[model samples]
Target: MSESSRWTMPDMAGILSNKIPQDELKPGDHIYSWRNAYLYAHHGIYIGDGMVIHFTRAAGQEIGTGTVLDRFIFSSSPSHPSGSPCPRCGDQSRTEGVISSCLECFLCGGELYLFKYGVSPGVFIAKTRGGTCTIAPSDPPEHVLHRAKFLLQNGFGVYNIFKNNCEDFAIYCKTGLLVFTNVSVGRSGQATSFLAATTAIVSSPLRFLTTGVSGLAAVGFGVYCVSRYVSDIGVRRDVMKIPVERLILCPGPLESEATTITDTSKEKGL
Candidate 1:
C-alpha cells in the first residue's frame, strides 16, 4: 500500500463481509489498517467475531489513496457468484455498514424500490415484499431538508421525496452531494439547490454509491468530492481520510510480482 496520486484522501463507508469470521470482530469495534498503522477508523459490523464487511476504499496510486470499493458482504460467498447474473446492480452490491442495513441491493446495483399500493386516499399498504406502508408527506421543504440532513448524517440514505408530483431530491452523502434529475419523482432545478456555492466546497469525507440516473445527475448536481490524505490537518474531524485497518483485513494475497494491475478507467491520473 502506498500514497495515492490521483486523490489525496480516503472516503466511503462499510468494510467487512460475513466470511471474515465475525467471531474475530463484532459491531462497534475499532478497525485498524494492516498496511499503514495510522490509517484506522470505526465501523459497526460483526454478526459474530472476525466477520464484518462494510463498503469502503483502499489506497490508490493515481487517485492518491481513495475509495475503490468492490466488496461482497456475505462471507460464505466471498467470490461474486459467477455464471449467475446480476439483473440489477444495487441488489447485487453488498458490503457492511455501521449505520446502514440493506440500503442497497445485494445482487444488482438497481435500488430496491419499496413502493406501496394505496387502498384509499389516506391509507395505504406496502405492496412491496417487505409489507411496508406509506406515511403522510412532509409539510414543508424546510422540514424535508431537515429530515434529509438527519437521515444522511446518521448514515442512512437520505432521500427527500418531495410532496408533489415533481421527482426532485437532494442527497447528502458522507462524501459528497448526489443530485439527480428526471430520476426523482420531484421537481427540476439547477444543481445549486443541492450544492452550495462553488466556494462552499461541501466536500464532505463521504463515499458515494450512485445508481440509475443518479450517475448522470451528479454532473448536474455540481457536487465535488475532494479527498485529503493523512497529512491533511484535522480532516479526520469530519471523517477519516483512509480506512487502513479495513484494507489490511481485506481478502487478498498481494498480486504476484509478475502481475500488473491496469487502469481501465478514462479519468486522468487514475
Candidate 2:
C-alpha cells in the first residue's frame, strides 16, 4: 500500500486512548477527556494502579448528587453474569459482560474507560495533553492521593459543576485549594454569577435602587455574562500554557515510573 493509502487507514483508537506513557503519572495527576470539541471536559485524578477517583453521575442520577467513586481506567470482567442484556450493547454473553457494565457506566455519566484489554468507546480518544492545572504542588503526590482517598472515604459527595466539579475535586486533591479554573463557563458559570449578583441586589435593595429593578436586572445579567466570558477565556488560556509531558496514563513500560521517581528523590534527599 502507498504511504497515502496508509495515512487514509482508520485510526481505531478509543476516544479516551492516547499515546501517553504511564510512568510519569503520579497519584493526584489531573487527567481529562474531551466531552465535546472544547471545554476542560471530564476530569479525574490518578490514584495509582490504573485507578482514578472522580465525581461522576450514573444514569438516572441528578446533578449535584453525583457520586465520587474510584474507577479503574480499564474495566474488569464482571465477577458473575447478570444475565440481563444491556440495552445499549445488546449483549448478554459472559465474555462481553464488561461491555454492558461499561455501557451502563457511560450511560450513567460515569467516566469512560478504554481498558488495556482493548475495549473501545466505538470512537477514538480525542487528542489531549496531560498537564497539571496548578504548578508546583505544595504537597507531595502521596499526600495528595491520600487526601483524595480520604475525601472519597469520608463522604466527599458534595458536587457543584461550576464550583465543585471533577476539576475542583482533582485540584483540591493536588493542592489544598478548592478551585476549578473553568468554573466561569457555560450555564454553570452564568447561573453562579447571576445568583451572586442577584443575591446581592436582593439582600440590599436600597443600595442597588439607584438602578430600578429592570435596570438592575439588566446590568447584573450583562456584567455576569461579560465576566463569565472573560474569566472562562482567561482560565482556558492559562491551563493550556501548562506543559503536558505525559500521556494521560497508558499503562505501559512506565507503569510505575512516577512512584519510582518519587522514591528515588526521597533517597537523594531532594
Candidate 3:
C-alpha cells in the first residue's frame, strides 16, 4: 500500500491497545482505566507529580440513573482493596466533583491506558468500544493542564452518566469543545455506545431490506458504527468551544442558549 493509504488504513493494534506504563505518562495526558469488567471506563487528566485530576460523584452515587447502573458504577471512585483510605488522597471515596488523586488511587487496580486524540476515522470506527479514543485534536499540554487544574478548583457541573461523567470531564479538559444540546449525549464515548446500540436495535432501517438473520445483524452493526461515528464530538457541528473560565461563570444560561440553538437548527433541518 502507498504511504498515504497506509496512514489511512485502520490501525487495529492502536485501536485495540492503549496500555501505557506509568513512566510513559506525561503531564496533561488524558488517561483512563477500565472498571466494572470493562462495562465502563473511568477517565482523568494526568497533571504530573503522580497526581490526576478527575470528575466524579460521591461514593455510592457514581450513576445517577437510580437503577442497577449505580451498582456497576460503585467502584468508579478511588478506593484501595485494603479497605483503607489512600494515604496521599485521604479518604476521598466520598468526595464529589473535580478532585485530585494520586495515580494509584485513580487506577483503582485497573490497567493504565492512554486516551488517543486526533485519530483517523478508520481507526476510530474500527474500535468497537467507545471512550477509548476520539477524532478530535487535543490542545497543547499546557492548555490541557490549565483546563484540568481550573476545573479542579471550579467544577464541571453535576455528574450524570449519559450527559456529564468522568469521560466527559476528561474530554473537555483535553479539548475545549462542549455539546450544546441537553437532549444529546456528551463527549463520553461510552454514553454514545449505549445510545448507538439502542438506535441500532430500534431505529435501523436495514431491517426492511434484510431478510436473513445474519443480514439483519450485519445491518444493525453497521448502523451502530455509523451512529457512533457521527455522534462523536469531533464529528458533530453543535459543539462550541468555550473557555473554562466563562463556562464556570455562566454555565447555566450558556447551556440553555446552546440547547435552544440546537433545537432551532434541527427544526430547520440543519
Candidate 4:
C-alpha cells in the first residue's frame, strides 16, 4: 500500500468488473473453490461458466491457475507517479510501471493477503486461525514482541476492523529479542473484543465491506493496471476445456487385478 503504487482500489474494481462481469461475479464474492482451489484472478481466470483456468509456474501444471492461496497475500511494487515505503511490510523498495498487488511476497509469511479488495494502511488486526498458534521471535533473555491484532472478514465488507488495545507487547532482554505473538484471552475484556472482531470477519462478508468507498480512487490509471497483472496473465492462457474425445482419463475399469505367483521361482520354473 504505497501512495505512488499503480494498483489502487478504483483501478482494481474496474478490472474485476470487466474480466469477471460485475453482475456474475457479485459484490461479496465467493471465488475460492476450496482448500486447494485458486479462484481469484491471481492464479487463474474465471471465464463465464463455472470454470477457471490458471497459468502456473509448475512445469506441466503451469498451464492454468496455480497453487491454492491457503493464507497467502498478493504483493506487487507500486507503480504510481512516485514511490513510497510499502504499508504492509514497510519495504523501502522502488517499483516502476504498474506493479499490481496480484503477485505475492513470502516475506509476509503467507498468513494474510488481499483478495478482491485492498488492505487499508494503518494499525492492522491479524487474528490467529483455529488450531494455528501465534508466536513472536525473540533473542535469549530479551523478548521484544510487536502485536498486530486480527480482524475477522465478516459480512461488514472491508473496513479493517479490530479494536486497538495492546494486549501483547515486546521487550528486549539479555538473552535475545524476546517476543510475544499470541497472548491468551484470559478474561481480558480488550483481548476478547479483538477475538470477536476476528470471528466476525471470517463469518460475515457484508460486515467487512460495509465501510464502503474507502477512498482508493486517488491513485491514477497506472496504479490501477498493476492490481490485475496476475489476473491479466492468467486470462491470456488457452486453458479452455477439450471435448470428451480429447480426454486422457480411461472410463473402463481393469478386467481384473493382475495376479503374481507367491514364488518367482515357480513362475520361472526354476
The candidate scoring highest on lDDT is 3
- In model 2, pairs of residues that clash are 14-124, 14-125, 15-124, 15-125, 20-247, 23-254, 58-108, 59-108
Q: Each model's TM-score, in the order given? A: 0.18, 0.37, 0.92, 0.16
TM-score of predicted model 4?
0.16
Model 1 is weakest, by summed lDDT over 10 consecutive residues, at 10-19
Worst 10 residues of 4 by lDDT: 145-154
Model 2 Cα lDDT, one tens digit per residue, 117-226: 11121121122122112222345767667666666555344455455455555555554432223334222222344455545445544446466778776655545444
Give stretches of model 4 more than 4 Å off: 1-30, 33-42, 57-114, 122-270
Candidate closer to the true structure by lDDT (higher is better), 2 or 4: 2
Q: Where in model 1 is the C-alpha error above 4 Å?
A: 1-22, 30-44, 47-270
True-vs-predicted CA distance for residue 95, candidate 2, Å: 23
> lDDT by residue for model 1 over 16-80, one digit each (tens)?
11122223432332121111221111122222222322222121211111224212111211112
Error of 2 at 83 (Å): 14
Candidate 2 Cα RMSD (Å): 15.6
What lDDT is obtained when candidate 3 is compared to the true structure? 0.88
lDDT of 4 at 14: 37
Q: Candidate 4's residue-wise lDDT over 1-270, tens digit each?
A: 666644556554533332333345421221221121221222222222332222112112211223454125222222122244444434423321111122122111122211232222110112111111112222321111111000111110111101111111101110111111133332112233435434443444344434544432222211322222211212212112212221123212211111122134347763
**Which one wins by TM-score: 1 or 2?**
2
